[model samples]
Target: MNDQAARLRRMIEDKHPRSDNKSNNIQENSKPEKLSANRGPRTIAITSGKGGVGKTNLTVNLAIALGNMGKRVIIIDADMGMANVDILLGTTSRINLMSLLESDVALEDVLLRGPYGVSYISGGSGMEHAMELTSTERDILFRKLAGCEEWADIILIDTGAGIGGNVLDFISAADEVLLITTPEPTALTDAYAVMKGYSSISDNPNLKLIVNRVIDEPEIREVVGTLSRTAERFLKISVECLGYIYDDQMMIKSVRQQVPVMAGYPESISSRCILSIAKGLLNGHQEKVKLGWRGFLKRIFRS
Candidate 1:
């Protein structure tokens, strides 16, 4: 792992000369413009209004599943203060992303490679400060990540729970927001709250939902139906239901063993559900935000 970290660091420093802060800071203006629209990086953020809805598990497995579809997937542990995606993957990160904001660690120094040949950047505990980037810093960080667009077909950000600034920033900046929830009433309400927050902030109307831990079809329909109506009534927005994953004990067992359920027990019911969701995402079957960085910037800086 140490050797891989060193190699990543060397690769970044040698190729990216502008990252002179030892923190992988790239000069925004100097960045080569995104050349073509030939399948650019698909940034998908997996977030929930409340925690304990298996958001991290969904993010991990989805990324791996996408990798299985022959796409170069990169998962970002964007949870900031309470990240644990590394735990689920059974790998200890030598240099987490917090080092880049706190100390002078390069961004390349922080990424940890995971199973199924996926690369990830750990958000680390106490990364809230990094979330508050100045405009210059924000541009730099985004541009640096944009460089990874060449290497990744999809970038999944496992965002922290709730509607906090970190979560909002992560989701709003993403190409699409994947809202994960269960059939619980509270989860439904929180999902509405998240959509409301998004509607209030930006007009980049693209939010997808994943109903997890389902046991009954009627109950799941009731929950999703309620959410859809609430959005239509208040926010005047709609949520695309990606799919549902049933409550399979194999999910729990895989977590206990620090492996994603998809890889540990691909034949499980939950795994099948996750695969269905992944297919819709990777094949572009669902709606997508048509906005580019300029549009996102306008939304971000709008009054």
Candidate 2:
């Protein structure tokens, strides 16, 4: 843990210097010069301070939203110990991400394609396994994940809540983190705990705040403003407001129907809100350099 932290923290803090055209991490003369695709796919981990704040729901629907915009998306349900994603997606997969560690199945075999060509990979029990992979196993896993750039433009990890090492490893290493929370006092306090856990190791995390189930725009402003101010005051990290989801009954209806609200009812308020957030993320308007999939994976399993 200490070694990976020191290596990754140095990498993170030195990103700007490394982005220069003259300096390169590559030594192979046979390889082509860098292209935009070489920057790799964007990896965003969506998590919250506590459960029941609609984090997984937001993850599935948000993936659909990005897919609708012609972006290839992958949602990895990394919220350990629960299959909420499969239950929500109305999918029951015999092969999961854990299968990769336990067997020789290909990465494509592990993927469950959701709406609009968006793929899903249940973290299954493999999240715990992932955090403790052998060196060879880790190499195989990263090789497969690195291929994601060929097909995917965005990868969203529906991470577990709390300050567990598993959750912290993902959110801390991600290109950006979407910290989901509610206006409730308990939820807000829990949200801060997660942020503190992330800030502990990351040199400077690119975090965005999303307030779910907001009743009104005024409430949105208050919730985001308060959280952002608190983070800046104590953690000394800025949290950007990435928009909010409304308290819509349609979300519940879609869940019961086993379809994402974005796909089931495009006109719903919740769908519109998610689409807006997706657009903000897709347009590259966010003020942060994405750490990419390779970078995210490199920060894992070195403890």
Candidate 3:
């Protein structure tokens, strides 16, 4: 291995030692992080029933916007099969979460930093094993992630489109879930299906809704109302109105520039809406870091 790889490997071995053998290593690494009251972060999963509903976009910008408002934020690209948050943010991550699970790497090693001072975990590929984490590993992962709650104010997980075990597992583990959808009929229908499924579960997630790429206020209310009414009448669950993002080409442009809308085009309506969403989630907000040379180094060299 190269110098950097060797150095990283040394760090891994120091912090989290390798198991007795390859099989044992797989079992040990697959185990989840342990939970402590002092865990470092609060995790929230952002999901959508269908693709092209702007769920990933909302996740990226909301994470950045939250960071701008002074909250320590980390985005977990939990969309296993088709992870692309790094691509959308224009970050070429050298490592990924899956690598950490498969090899002996610190979670920090796989994280990517983004605009507005946000940290993101790239959802890399080639880990079919991740689908079936051991019960011990699952517990260990959660415990370690929960430890993050001790440090981070918000941990946003961007789940893949559709309602599978992988996506559902992320949702179930989160403190809250933000479901995004567009005004299109198909999107609405699929979103409702997802909500219905959640409501049917005996242990459902704390669900919230956001309508993206909206045309106007009426569309926002209408879409939110549809999901709300269905939840009330059918699922018997309450869904909060997180807010909406208007149709703006600037969003696509900002993505092209590898910058969040909040920074790339701050004054845009979409950016304003995202800020409003962060405010609505006010109870979850925390104090921002005092950015300086010390803070910068601390974040870069988190121990």
Candidate 4:
């Protein structure tokens, strides 16, 4: 692991302070635990109520950060018409998730290898047509999606930003939802809107919030607290404040270079913030048994 990643592990120990159990065995000097083979991958749908909130940027970097901590990560560009995970990674793919639905294609053929051993499957209009598959085709596709658990300990789905049925389907199906938003009033409002739509569909929704481009601690607190309180008081739903990222110029440079900051600028403050979020995310859920891909697909098809 790089210095930034190592610092992140130490920072997590100082801040989160885990219990002294074999399962929670993350130490400052020792390596992070290898993902357990007994359980399935933890599938998290990363979405936003609106675009240009650094949703995709955060998704790409966070995956690499988590992978740095010894977790296998897979990203799915569920952005449909606006698919760009491959582009962000400076790679191109002719085949995608849709290939499986159209014929007897294997998942290996569609996966795109990103930096830091992170593999992603570009939705590339594949997600747009995923729901249109025939009964048999849909069954095959769902099974292929389920088999994704074999390739990852953590599966991050970058769903398109919106309140549309397609976006909500992926959000509701995943084991957890990480909603991204900025400090803009419109972004916050739309975040609420997405939460409202999601709450109506799933009686029990695991909605997590992450504020991007925050200028200070107070700003993040205001954004996260306001959203969490609003969801609980008005919509009768709870939203977890996963973490926040600071405004950093390195991020812009990384985007232009089509390289993730976690690798391109690991020492940047933004990268440190991302690593912190990754560590907290992993440690917090160590005890929880994630449902994995099969569970995610079951919910996806039912919805």
lDDT of each: 0.72, 0.77, 0.66, 0.78
Per-residue alpha-carbon lDDT of model 1 for 123-187, expressed as tens digits?
A: 66423555355665555444444445544667788888889766786678667888999888788
Q: Under the 3 Å rule for N, CA and C atoms, how many clashes does model 4 have?
A: 0
Estimate TM-scores for all models. Answer: 0.79, 0.84, 0.75, 0.85
Candidate 3 residue-wise lDDT, 1-303, digit = tens: 233554565567558754443322113433323322222355577889998788778888888787777777777776765556776777666666556554445544455555456677666542224446655554444333332432366678788777864565556545667899999999988898888766665264478898999998888888998889988898888887878999999998988887878878989999999989988877644443323221211221231
Task: Indicate the TM-score of model 2.
Answer: 0.84
List candidate 1 segments past 4 Å from native: 1-39, 101-107, 125-127, 131-140, 284-303
* RMSD to true structure for each model, in Å: 7.4, 9.7, 10.4, 10.9
Ranking by TM-score: 4, 2, 1, 3
> In terms of TM-score, which candidate is stronger, 3 or 4?
4
Please give the lDDT score for candidate 2: 0.77
Give candidate 4 misplaced runs (Cα > 4 Å): 1-36, 102-104, 286-290
**Which regions of candidate 2 deviate over 4 angstroms?**
1-36, 284-289
lDDT of candidate 3? Answer: 0.66
Give the C-alpha lDDT of model 1.
0.72
Off by over 4 Å in 3: 1-40, 102-104, 125-128, 134-147, 202-204, 283-303
Q: Give one clash count per candidate, in the order shown.
A: 0, 0, 24, 0
**What TM-score does prediction 3 earn?**
0.75
